[model samples]
Target chain A: MRPLIRMAWATSRRLLLLMSPLLAFYLALMVVHQVTKRGTDIPAIAFTCMFMLIIVSTFQGLTFDVEGFMASLPVTRAQLVRTKYLLSFLGLLAGLALTLAVAGLAHALAPGRAAAPTPEELRSAVALALVDAFGLFAFLPFVHAFEPSRGILAFSLAAILALAASLAGWGLDGAADLFRFFQRVLAQPAPALGLIGGLLAFGLLSLSLSTWAYARRSF
Target chain B: MANLLELRNLSKSHGAFNLRDVDLAVPAGTITGLIGANGAGKSTLLKLVLGLLPLDGGEIRLFGEDARLGGARLRQRIGFVQESPTLFPLLRVDELGEVVAPFYPRWDRATYRRICDAFELPRKTAFARLSQGSRMKAALALALSHEAELLLLDEPTSGLDPLMRRDLLDLLLEVIQDEGRAVLFSTHITSDLERVADHVAILKAGRLVLAGAKDDLLESWALVRGGEELLEGPLKDRCRGGERTELGLTLLCEGAGSLASLLPDGALQERPSLEDLVYFHDRGKESLCAR
Candidate 1:
């Protein structure tokens, strides 16, 4: 556990350093959007870019020779994978907090020009981020199991296929009814709690898969 | 003396290269030099013992426990230095030490500092900024500071200057003087092994061709030079690896005592060096079957 924490700290430090430029650019863009009254989804756009960058950087770091160095240590592969997952989760949490802070600052600077996110909008954004985080987190196991290029291709294919399935589902006769059901569920507190519970379970499932793949890996 | 490290029926295959049924043991208080040519599976074997590579078949026991089942706990008792130190490049030397020290239960900070001073390592320099030799020294410092009972090193001396190599060897010798510790290092440099290694294990084309006490192996094989007539006579079958020089036929033969009776009066016999053994074993096609 100590090794895991140490590794996570080191990984987070490197991630923060690597993303500093992008973070600055996003902040500048937020300020401009607020000043010009462009009415852009600044928080969402920033979140999306930051999320993608985090995923790419985390994958690159894991697949690089860093894995070799870590393997040589006294830590087991399961511990290493868990540390990576912890680091990625921390990165997402930090990115979300920074994005929200920037958005709040932008709102404060131009009170009448751009509106701040309402409570509902903030809740929805957090929920969506949680879902995206889990989806991205699940791909880490595949990345560890395959070569870099193949891993990227596999992740891309999985994303495309999922998108296609969602689109195809929307074309079905009962699709609108299912969408209305989800809307009602989100509107109610108890059902929303259930949704969050389900997402957490899914995330844990992904972590289990990653641990299995990593433990079986041969350096 | 108990064996600190043991391997039996160890086997792994990577395409054309195969480590077949390797059996070895390293007793405590001795340095075992694993000498082999390039691509001779030295690194592969080391990695397997470290659990970096999965074994196709075999058992690795370090300190009387099965290595695979021992997990990180057993690994704490061992230290390893790879051919290229795969340390994080962005971290400074001190930061790297801080990160790794917590993993080993017996980490000795005072010893680490002492080794750092002795090696003349720059603690504040980023790993990428250090010279190759310095980076290796940093790695060595970390490995030695752990109070490990067994050390596994792969090509640790390959890139250093002669003086640094001597210093590293002396350090290893000092480490093994405690008698409760052991070192297994792989290198193509036989002279280094000749200087410090109590036992020598020679690998050729992924198989351990010869392994035993260094002195005993040298005494067993004799380098003999005789006329061409000896090649066609009774000595032909006994010759391990031979070259037809302009002067005569030079060969390595196992039975030195019997060679005196079979060869002509002018035949010469000399002790074979580790290099001669590896050269003849790897390069001499007929020598492969002779072993």
Candidate 2:
């Protein structure tokens, strides 16, 4: 457990340092959104850019031949794979928490009476987070398994798919269908429970893929 | 003496390059120098032992146990120095140690500090900023600090100056003086091995061509210098490999002392060095089947 912590610190320290400025920028954008409420789209654009940066940067630790270095150590490849999934899961939760915080602050600072977050708003946040998480886990395994270029290529393909999704209106159509489906599911008492299960399932699947890749890889 | 590490029928395939079925052993209280050409799979063999590369066949036994590397046994028992040091570029030497130390249960802080001081390594310097030689020194120091039973070093002396190489070799001798510790040192500088290595293993194009005690190998392998006519003589049958020098033909023969009687007057028969073993292995197509 101590070795795990030390290895985690070694690999994630750079990502943590890099996240500080991104977090600040995110919080600052939230502040701007609450002040005007007029340029709501601005925050989404900023959020998308920051989230993509995070996706790309998630495996930046692997770029410096960390695989070879870590391979030399006593830590099992299984443990390394587990650590990656663990960090990514934590990052996903952190992203959702930040969204909730921003939402709460917006409600508190409103000119009108403070109210709990609407069901629609909650669903929107969940949808966005899932899509982002899906995009991340898709690339994380390949990046960790192979060379750094695999990460770049994976993300590049993602960007292209995202562009195509927007150009062809697949993103809008899918989101509208998703919103309707969630609107009904949100009426259920344990909607959050279901979402958590889905997230775990996805995380586990990603973990298995990466573990297999890392296990078979040669430094 | 007990073998600290053993590789039996170890093999790996990377496209056209394949590390064929090869066997070698490192006994405790000995330093076995691994010598080979660049593509001869010295680094590959080291990686296979560390489980950095997947083994295609056979088994690796560590400390008399059929072992899987990257496990608790490997973590506590082996220290590895890569051909190119892979210490984190952003971390200082001390910081890298701080991270690596916890992984090994028996890590001694005092030993680490002493080695750092002895190596004259800048504890504050980030690994990326260190010179190639300094980086190698830092890596070796870190490995030594752990006091692992088996040290797997790949090309550790490649970047050092002559004096530094001598110092590192001397340090290795000091370390091997300990009862149960051993090292598999891979280097192009066979002279360093000649100075310190008790045993030698030479690889050629991914095959273990020759491996045995240094003294015995030197005693049996002979370098013969004579006219081109020698290559046409019955002596040619004994030559493992031959190269043309400015003066005449030089043949590397396996039966060392026996060659002296066979060579004509004015022809020379001397014991072959480790360098000669590697050069002859590369220059000769046929493997030196004799150890």
Candidate 3:
């Protein structure tokens, strides 16, 4: 196996081991919800996003404890970093796949419905998943690379709080205006272009900062 | 000939603890034991050599390659085992070797299998569930499997039982029998070093007190037993810190060849053991005040 792929394999195997139980729980929840009248795609998607966020942070943050072991290896720090990024990207992809599969299956197998996701809804789901995963992914390296220890936890908690605040803001009258603005942006190709641009800028900027921090870091 | 590992004026400071102008060398084809008291800079020095901790003020060359500036290529030739075995918690024993094999071009699967058999490690056991000795052996197995020329072991035997310690040391000796392989093992167990170390370096309070051939150190430093007057008259300066007796004083100092002329006729000089030399050198002031 290639070195990076081997590292990813090791990482993914560990991830599976840790998440096996959670995966079981997720499956059970989907099964129960599908059996009951509770017909919704949002639940599965939410669970996946939350699982991705938690698992990525915990597993990626693991490097702190294993710094000694990683140093003992013949691999470079850059390889280690690249492997972690690849593993996380794979994880996000896995989560996205799970969400799509479960949601599609539930919609198809529902008691009284034969509804499938429209093209627009499919595009929206993909867009939302990418936005959520990439946004979290871009920010997490800064958490692990620069923050170290309690720093990541603190940043993550603050992010969770911000997300909760955003949800609460959804109840306000201004939330409708924000949603209308969002719809307008989504209606045109300019929004997608803008999102991709912003993501690129943020991803590169944060990754560069992380690389600098790691390069100069002791251990 | 260039040594396998060399540290020139390596210095690193940790607030209260400081390793000052540390210079160290380990020749190829020899096992060099690093002995030091707790809180000494043994771990710090090992970290510098491994590039785990950055050097504050010096240079380290491994296999004649500059350590501080070394890239992945240099690391491929070196293997490290930490005091605590930090294997991936979820990885099974058999899976570990495979996971680590890709990083090194010269990784020897056959040798790894041999080490596993010799160590009696179970292939299916998760690293987190293994006992301390087993965990250490697993780490050692991974390190040795890489066909690395230089092995830097930091207190690899710290938590092992006597039997396990013997097994580990025996494996190390066997590994280094190839002559080109060299090891710098930092350990507190002097007896283990006595068995395998061709050269020993003693670090005390973050400084080297004695470093040379094991036999030479044992031969050069001797234990002298004499009365107070005998200790005061001619052997005072020559007397190293040692135990005290009511009728006389026991001191560890330079061997009789160096101090025989200065000692009184009644004082007896005896060869010191490796442990005794370490005890004397490490107890710096306490050994001196015992008199």
Candidate 4:
């Protein structure tokens, strides 16, 4: 367990280092948006960066030679897989905290033009991020089974397709209706709890699949 | 003497290569040198014993317990140094040690530091920044610090300068002198083994062709050089492997006493080295195929 935690910390440290440049870019964009009094979608931008971080970090964890080295140690396959998930979870929390801080700074800087996020908006952002983050988390095991570069390519393709679907959703009446339904669900506590529950179950299922694949891997 | 490691009917196959029905043992307090050609399944056998690769068939018993059932706990008692250093390149040497130390219950920080100091390993240097020799030394330090009973090293001496190789071999000898520790290191460097290995196992094309006490193997096999006519007549069946030159035929044969009796007084009978055994064994296979 200590080994796993140590691995998680190492992974998280690497992930943060890799994400630093992109984080700087996002911060620059936020500052520009604040000074110009432009209406930037803060939550959406934060979520995108979070998703990218997760993808990049997952790719790094799966592709590193350290995985083989770790396997040679007295650590089990299950523990290795679990450490990956733990890293992703920790990265998510860190990313969200950073995003929140950036959004707060943007609001504070341009108090007359930009408004602070409402409590309801914060709830929706948190709930939506959870769903998106866990949805991506579910694919990590499968991604990990691939070569690191290929895994990143695959994740990038999936992310692009998802972006395309979201863009295409604006054209579909049923999609708008679904968005309205989500807004209503986010306003209430019960359905939001159900959504979070469903996401957790799906994430766990993905984790189990990853563990099975990793356990059977040759190295 | 009790066997520290045992393999019975072990088998594994990958594409055109197959390691078939291998049965071998290493007694406690002895260094067993696993020598073979480039594709001779030496690494495959070590990986199998380490449980890095799942077995296609057979059983591996270490410390009188099934290796598969031994799980992570069993692995804790065995240390391994791969042909390439497998430590994380991004981490400093000290950080890599910290990351790996918690996995083994018997990890000794003092020993790790001692080895690092002796090896002249740069504790603050990232693995990627270290020289190949330095990385190997760091790897040795980690493997030794765990207090493992059995050390399974795959080509630990490869790529090192003669001085470094000798140093590592000396360290291996020092480890086995404890009487509770045993080592099985695979190498193409026969001279290194000649200096230290008590038991030698020769693998040829995935098969354990010859294995025994190193001194006994040297004593039993003789390198015979005699006339080609002698090879064709008296030594035809006796010669393990030979090539006919214009002057004579050089042959590696078993049973030195028999060869001395059969050969003419002009024929040369010399003691076989580990390299001689491997060369003749490989040539023997080629000749068998040609026939």
Q: For each candidate, what is the lDDT?
A: 0.78, 0.76, 0.73, 0.79
Q: Per-residue lDDT for B239 in model 3?
A: 61
Candidate 2 structure quality by residue, lDDT tens digits, A171-218: 555434544555456467598578657766877788888888888888
Q: What TM-score would candidate 4 get against the native?
A: 0.89
Ranking by lDDT: 4, 1, 2, 3
Instruction: Tell me the lDDT of candidate 2.
Output: 0.76
TM-score sort, best first: 1, 4, 3, 2
Which whole-number lDDT from 0 to 100 does residue A5 have in model 4? 80
Q: What are the models' TM-scores?
A: 0.90, 0.87, 0.88, 0.89
* DockQ metric, candidate 3: 0.55
After superposition, candidate 1 runs with Cα above 4 Å error: A38-42, A45-57, A109-114, A147-149, A161-185, B285-291
How far does residue A146 in candidate 3 sit from its true spot (Å)? Answer: 6.1
Model 3 chain A weakest lDDT span, ten residues long: A172-181
**Per-residue alpha-carbon lDDT of candidate 3 for residues B130-202, written as tens digits (9 for 90 to 100):** 9888888898898899878999999988878888789888878987887888989999899999899988998
Per prediction, the TM-score for chain B is 0.95, 0.93, 0.94, 0.95
What would you estimate as the lDDT of candidate 1?
0.78
> Which structure is stronger by TM-score: 1 or 2?
1
